[model samples]
Target: MAMVITVAIAVATELAIVGAGPAGMAAAEVAAGHGVEVTLVDEQAVPGGQFLRQPPPQFGVSDWLGDPVYREGRRLLERVSADRRLEWIMRSSVAGIFSNGDDDGDEPFTLVLNPVGEGDSGEGGAPRQLSARRVLIASGCFDLPVAFPGWTLPGVMAAGGIQAFVKSQQLVPGKRFLFAGSHPLQLVVADQIVQAGGSVAGVLFAQSSSRALALLKHPSVLLGNADKLSQTAGILWRLRRAGVPVRFRQTVLSANGTDSLESVTTVPVGPDGAIDSDAAEEIECDRLGVCFAFSTSSELARQAGVDCRWDASRGGWIAKHDDNMASSVPGVFVAGETTGVAGSDIAALEGQVAAIGCAAELGKIDARQAVELARLPRRQLSRRARFARLLSELAWPGASLFDQLMSDSATLCKCEGLTVGMLRTQLGRHPDIRTASAAKLLSRAGMGLCQGRYCHFALTRLMARQLGVPEERVGGFTSRFPAKPVSIGRLIGDDS
Candidate 1:
């Protein structure tokens, strides 16, 4: 690294949105439209969120408006990019949000970012730091992957990640692939793989029609925008037309492979949601796709000291926000899946609503306008939340998922390489030490790798079940400085 000094300019960078996904980008555009200066930062080189992915050039689609949600998302990004007041900073991450000093005599957020190498980095080299008066967090959710035996195999990957790779880089892991998981994603990925010149061995669905029936009770999912339903049906039709085997009510109990994934042993569960031994079978395949679904992006909000609660129906821990998407912490706001998992449409609406609230806070927009813009999403949220809740209840991961976790195998901390037995031993005689901090004190599960992203939910679930406490009653993991992993060298920057 070399040393250099750049002039630091002070401007009206009123709001900083942390993700370029639909929600975050929408917040920036809407806020800027209301006369506020906004900065939208994302780790990706482009603005589309994971769901509204823009495939690589080799894929032959300049703009694939295959679905209605994607079409609208693309339009939104275009509008945001065209706006002069909205600054787009790609290839940067919001390491942490701090209110440490008076910049220009104004108390604003201090954001730390790191830039990576060429292709991976949004711009070019290392990350840079900036300041903003108001901060809006919309860092979208990441897929939750539960490790199975032999899951460490090279050919195994999360379905969402695989789809992202196919869309972003026009790359496929293998020719023959097996995608097994909850509905929508399972069929969607299976169809994409086939379209991408990959062979689908089989589609093992962990959900059944019984769950789908429950999913329909909520009217919002029923009144789903025409585009989403079309895409969902199209994927299902493609899988059926391709003659791909579809296995329902089955889940991967274990992955069997020496070097890579050679086979997957699946257990077919009965209507009662227990594995039926008689229906268990082994499926041979070179690639395996597994997903435990997705969790919220409440890490930043949690780190900012906002109040959070666990809503299993909404997917993991979510921030406690009002109708306006304002967090408990003043001058801070949250939107999209980070608040809860309600799919893309709802996330977009929430993002827009958050922007309106932000405008009101900055005196750029009136409360009446904010209220009017927020109504549709509130109604949609109320209408479909029940059904989402039902589906979540039905799709809840069973306690058996972790029952057999090898005591000596990697546990609490995936990045730091901590193990379960080590964590258990650290608790010593404190039998009631069940919080994330307690687990961290014992074995550093939430302290390494993702800084609690991967293990936080699992740990909370396990502790709640073990102690017979309600999930909502359980507290969340506490984070420290450098909310994300940071290098000492980067902190010192050119001064080094």
Candidate 2:
């Protein structure tokens, strides 16, 4: 083979952290411990994720805003902050994932991040691109709530976004709410809202208790961490004790109100996992907190062209990885929820494992010692994986949920203002429309108001079903420069 040479060199100086969440912070902590210089970057100004959301200005340091996972995340970031080699860049988001060459060493890969104030400047005020012997992506998960007829109403929101609102701004999305979802996240947010003095009509599960219990029957899950098991039990108990109705095997078919959400029409799913319209019931609530589940935030990973898989058991399509937490793309390693559905603690462990693996790959650590060091985190991760699988199965998005709202007009691609009928036609015309990229190109399905955040999952599932690939294998959209919406003038490098 002829040796290929390329001029595209990724600037190498220090290890770059793509996120400042639990996973990123943990990776930086372990990597720094191993004497590797680390740079941590994130869209948020703080370390804790949307879960351990930062307190408002009104609160100094209140128990009003802390969780075990969050406390652990803060401690890890604190340790990383103390390290002289670590750099924490807040209010920065990853813009692009570029590989100048292949694994043949003809080209190198670089991660580009745009700071909040500094816009697009290929040179001046351009994003800081760090070349590294190894890179860890712990970007975390993004939820996709299938849109209903009245979902665009002012008060309706994703269960996760509502939680973020409370955590960040101390703002309640609505005074009266009905949280409808099965995941542990739904309950977590419901409790947060109630604790904040908001009235929650009920918390409903689209999946049946039998389904959830069936997942718990997995022997690996049964033997998983006692803390998580106990925590789940406590949440269920609290819901029951508080007289909060927990409905199961129910789906919120539609929300109806003039300008805002007023009530939702929910229906029951039968034994064959089909929704029965005749069993519909109208529940009055100010807000509908809805989300099926979440998958890895693959914006950066996909841009780098890392292979992904639709492991429903791991929370939809996720980046593929080996025991070392390294992706198929050699130096590009993935940690945390970006890889799978393991909780924050598991993500932290995976981040540490990636750091250890990175150190060995960079020849900073002896292979023999790396092997020994990898065991503890791996064992802990195995336990968490067991629980994660159980949780995924317990809350898997059922096909019938879509069938319940399968309308010719029900908006599927909210970003592009696209409906199911339009997407179907576009898919037929462009048989190659098998990924978020294709959808964006053909029908502009992900190019509307929310910028594909709401429609990406539906596009993935629809395309996967059409192409006969696992949902995760369907691929995702490539994140471009100005990760978030930025002014063109700002992108053109003008502060004033």
Candidate 3:
């Protein structure tokens, strides 16, 4: 069920799945049911992806959140692990996906994999490769990096990153945490921190509660998600009892401290997401959790030459998938947040539909059977999509908010230590710097270690706002191969 294939030779398979998240797990299960062979590659040691992120074995964590919140994920993981046909290549990342044949040829996909923690030393291990007849990418999303002043400080981190620490490390990494974001995930993280005997200074929402809560009035959004609704109510009730302030129409204007986060200034944001700087309040806290938005982890998809369309509401560029979740590229399928940032429930639904489509295409099942198998998941996905849309609408801090938060001195690209002032100077010189790619060349904003993951959106926002064009015209970075950083040694090993 699992392996650490250290060989440089590529192990060919019928289907290769990327990511071991909810969508990937679901697809593996469905693919197995169809008697299809699958090789799933994930960066985590465990099967669960971010949503079901687990504590490392050394942590000795056994409590499963003490709720049914993770029960389904646990079950899914158990089922996937029990299947012998589904092979898991854990603790490894697909550095790049190369077509094994000509551009027009339909040859297998060659995946260059680097051991997750193994440095390029070529001492611990060599870079490996996996070959698959067809590929499915379900790489999820990550916290949207919005650079306000002091966000690059040591103690200032994304809410999701903080939550990942709590979930995967069994350690609350901070004290006196102040959460400022429009995403509801922040509430879950706050509750987790509070339950772990940590202090929550407060949780702030930029949008007023009434506007977001109005969507709950819809019966469709409320139905079939009782467990989730109950869990939310419990979290809210516990936070209230803990005397943690949950404020609305508030946003973190800027963080304060020279070396680490000591406090953050909060100000009331208008419906337009512009802050009223006069009504600012400075709150003392060691940790600042910013959860404004999430961007699709589509770097690999883009590198694989798949089509992506920009939709800020869906989280930057989303892979273009047909109804069956097959991407524009032949034999390349996509699901979950890579398609767009709906919830995990919808992710599983999309995974099921995608797996069924894969099964049909592989001749493992008949088209009629595939249609019937996909019907229920598709129906459920439609319902879940509605609720997710409502939630996304509520969580999206208006596009203007990024420009307003980006002060001249704020670090736009943390990796390169590039600031807004530096970017503006480059724009003044270039005059034609209208896209992230161009800006990256002119200002070196996106050429950092993160490859513009942290600064591309902000840079695009800066360019679009300055040029008075949509962020679409101010396009995202041109994705390149070796999507993640790889050692020169590994590249040599892959080549040799």
Candidate 4:
């Protein structure tokens, strides 16, 4: 059940921070230390974001993330939850943020909040609107949707989604699991499943072991992230002891089953990135967990008129920010993976810098003090940035390379039930279709219940290549207000 928060929004706050993960939590800590009044909101019921997602207080759950690997996150959560200065509005989402057209910079933004889950009474959002002098968007990222053969099967799931089930719900959704992808995230999720006493068929990587090792052996990666490296090594050791096979240069060709996944076809990829279908191996597993990359949740920022750019290696359509993490628009700031797909450590540092920047902007602190506070976090961020670049290279598997995995009969838009051939026919019918929005209207690809989040990545790749343009030129779906779906009952509910 959602936590129905009773918000009294009679007055405006000096700063409003969205997301309660590392970035949002860390920012609130700094804001409190600097004596700034903050309204910290999160879509989750708890403080932890995706990386440190914790179960609700009433779940009677404990010690899920208590492992040594998550020590830093645990410490941060403890500090932030104990902070009384920060006001929280949890289990709710920001529908839209509108800037006052006038030049009055003081409290110039209005935020519309709507209750989520079944607990909401479906009243039209009126009294829920709140005012803020500044806004920090730290909305995180989600799994990169890969539309391949039989990807929409009932038993197929994103690797991160599987991890969430085990971590928060303490329930393994499937008995047997097969993980396949380019990034090491699959390895981590597989280890979690194994620890949860779930059967694992195997873990496959598209890249060779040598290439991944050389990147891990980088001096910067080794020195700056010793804890992270240690945790990864521990997870690998556990997986090996559990008798889980970890293979290299291997990828999933397709998932075959009647109604749900009963088996998966695995194919070996050569050093030149060529798939060897003649030596395909069939692995029986009830679940297929695929982790290619991540897609940032920057729709709210974009809807607020913030500028964003695409970098397929990182989370796509990321908000552009300056040294202080301030967005191009005045009085609006962003941090964490929404800025890019860096890890939580880098996100926390960026959050501190953004908080101090906000304090300076709102006159709670002097310019010199803000610089002094941000200097250390900025220095730490630069060191982490070097390692993040190396990881990006490993995470990025060009969309064209997916041709070997996805077949023409594969469903492109699960929401619309549109197949790859259907989309291709639409593209072929209209040679001038270049942008994603055009492709959406022309082919009806991203028009569905998911609002294109699931299909947009795949659609952008197809449209960009067909039109001979970059994904950036293809542009993302037009970020509309009410970024999340609201019920018609709520829309017409009496404001009184």
Q: Which candidate's lDDT is highest?
A: 3
Residue 460 of candidate 3: its Cα lDDT? Answer: 83
User: Distance (Å) between predicted and true CA of 62, model 1?
Assistant: 3.4
Point out where model 3 deviates above 4 Å.
Answer: 1-7, 102-107, 120-123, 215-227, 494-496
lDDT of 1 by residue, 1-496 (tens): 5533232332337888888787887778778878888888787777777866666434676546454535666788678767777787776666677775664445467676655344331333444667777788888887774644555567888888888877677688787888776535656677778887888988775657667434323323322232245556666678778888876777777677777788887888666666665666888888888755677877777877778887754657887888788888777888878887766666777788888888998888777877887787678766666555555555554545444332245354566665555654655556778676776666667876478887776667666766678766657777665566655544543324
Winner of 1 and 3 under TM-score: 3
Task: Indicate which candidate wins on TM-score.
Answer: 3
Q: How much lDDT does each candidate structure score?
A: 0.68, 0.70, 0.83, 0.81
Q: Give me the overall lDDT of model 2.
A: 0.70
TM-score on alpha carbons, each prediction: 0.87, 0.86, 0.94, 0.93
Candidate 2 is scored at a TM of 0.86
Q: 43-97 in candidate 4: lDDT tens per residue?
A: 8888889888897787976567766656777899899899888898887788778
Where does model 2 exceed 4 Å of error?
A: 1-12, 56-58, 65-71, 81-85, 100-109, 117-126, 213-226, 428-436, 449-451, 464-475, 478-496
Q: What's the CA error at residue 392 for candidate 3, in Å?
A: 0.4
Candidate 3, residues 159-235, lDDT tens digits: the string is 98999999888888988999998777788889899999999999998888886455323322321132366666787
Clashing pairs in 1: 91-122, 114-127, 115-126, 115-127, 412-445, 413-445
